[model samples]
Target: MDSSAGHTPEPGSPDEPVVVLGVVAAPGQAIGLARKLVEADLTDHIQTTFPGARWQLELLEAGVVQPPAGDAEIVDATRDLLLEHEWDLVLCLTDLPLHVGKRPVVAHANAVHGVAVLSVPALGATGVRQRARGIITGLVGQLLGADADDLREHQKSPARSALRHRVRQLGTDVDEAGTAFTARVLTGNLRLLTGMVRANRPWRLALGLSRALTGAIAAGVFALVTADIWLLADTFGGIRLTGVALGSIIAITATLIIGADLWERGSSRQTREQVALFNIVTVITVVLGVAAFYAALFVLSAIGALCLVVPQVFGATLDHPAGFTDYLEVAWLTCSLATVGGALGAGLETDEAVRDAAYTQHPAEPI
Candidate 1:
């Protein structure tokens, strides 16, 4: 289960290997600590194999609580062996805070590598998720550059594994990862390497398209109400209309939006500033949309004054059929419907929207 030792020298480092030493100073971040060093292409400071460039890897592990003997003493013991073995670089991985302090080990590593040490902090839960996503996306973009379909093949290869350890930290139950695993395997056959970039477009366009379609439908509904109601009022008895359902719809719409925002933000989100900002932005969008539409509707209603009233029992003379009341009613109704419609679209097609929102900025900086 500990694929830890499997990274042993292949065909064995006969002549000399690029030496790497990893110290999983923290308890939980060992998995990431391991790969961050070995997967150089995933994270840092290693030369990719090119013309006349050979990369042979050698890795060692130690612990923060009990480092492998004194730094000076170990370096001394290994100095002769390293010269004999010919190591190009010596890498030390640790998560201990003191390791970065004006400590001696870091100084020693600096002396060895000719520059300051290259280090990655202990990836806590949040860091783990972000780093893992970065690795996957980076790998998807860089090596084995495949479309959506080729992901499985990429996964099976070294390119896919560029960030596997960090990915393992996502805490997806091993059981649930089964589906993801299978999906990856099948992905190689479709959406070839080039397709991932094409498929993973941003949220604005997708959401904008959906919004336009829904807006067209809502407009259709509003037009029907106007035509039917106007004809009925002229034929029978015309009554000034107050949309009775407006308030109830507003309350329902608000509840759904606030509830969904709460759920998405999660209990870990304690700061209210961000939520308030989002709400303010959303309210502004709604107000603008409503105000524009209602103003236009009111103008049309003023034009409606030219028509005759039918079934004249309800003698309500009007300066305009569409009054301030109609503007208020339409504005309220438009916002409620828009909110509900937006929420439904977001919830129903969550896979796409969520993926888009999360990955809007492509390829996070690696480690």
Candidate 2:
């Protein structure tokens, strides 16, 4: 058995079957969980879908491979990789987007190569197991030329799976499937959704901005207690707080964007169009996130002032009155201080977290 290139010929008997699950560019966590979920009940599911066929499912994580071109290229590349192993059928799951012409496809399989490739973006926000189940079942049914009933049995039955809208194929005899796949993928606009999801992972963003946020909080607290800050707050009003929030958001966002770009430092040069899009989305996400942070800090400062302030010393300069105005002065001072502290925190942020918050296209290269 030459495991160099070309397809692995299938066994003459249908009694025993060899299936390989090849993972490339897939997230480590998702793959681990999905494999456990599928392997637990794979035999039963396979038997139900294919009746009396005995199957052996083997899992392989190939890490990152050189990316291929289009659907046909991916089919060829997947087949080539599987040729080195003894497997009758190979299911390749990749995190990278798979495109057919202008539209991105969820999955594509070649009956000739006995190989299928599924794009992770097609899974949406569903649990890893269910997404994997739907894709694998669909591939098996399509690859083996299953009867309509068998195919129907494996295809995602739940309306929420939304797998129907996502899964599609090319480079096969399924012309209608190819056309429909393109149309559905384009209409669904999964590419944009995938980017948004990638960019909007709040936990990742928070981790990236941990130091900056901490600095801001500490600064806010200090400002709430300091005499100079109170004096400045007395001189200004809501105008001062608004300015502080805007300034802080801008400073933190710029720091993240710059830091991420430096960290990523792609080998390939990005085009103007790519640069524009990246900047636009990065700015938007940062602005939205920082706005929330700033607002929360503002509320915290207000509350802290009410509880911690000795009213007489904190706002003794209101040449007019001493009700909510005093607290407002303290809040304004804290907001400004917090923004400056957050800027300092930006310097303390780790490069990795900044990259996570800023990038959607490429993973951070090892430092």
TM-scores, all models, native as reference: 0.26, 0.46
Q: Give lDDT per model, in order.
A: 0.32, 0.54
Q: What lDDT does candidate 1 reach at residue 256?
A: 33
The sequence of per-residue lDDT tens digits that candidate 2 reaches over residues 1-367 is 0111233233345322223344433456546655775558855665454432344566776533455444555554555555454344567777667653356667765443446677766668767566666567666554443334434543545222222211211111111233453344334433433344343543345445778879988888877877777677777767866776677678877776676543111122211112222344456566666666666777888899899877676435545555787686678668767866887887777665564343322111101
Candidate 2 has which clashing residue pairs, if any? Answer: 3-84
Q: How close to the true structure is residue 333 of candidate 2, measured as C-alpha lDDT? A: 66
Native-referenced Cα lDDT, model 2: 0.54
User: Candidate 2, which segments miss by more than 4 Å at Cα?
Assistant: 1-204, 262-275, 357-367
Q: State candidate 1's TM-score.
A: 0.26
The residue ranges of model 1 lying beyond 4 angstroms of the native Cα positions read 1-216, 223-347, 351-359, 365-367
Q: lDDT tens digits, residues 206-268, model 1?
A: 243354336434643453245344443334321223232244234323433453342222122
Cα lDDT, model 2, residue 24: 36
Worst 10 residues of 2 by lDDT: 165-174
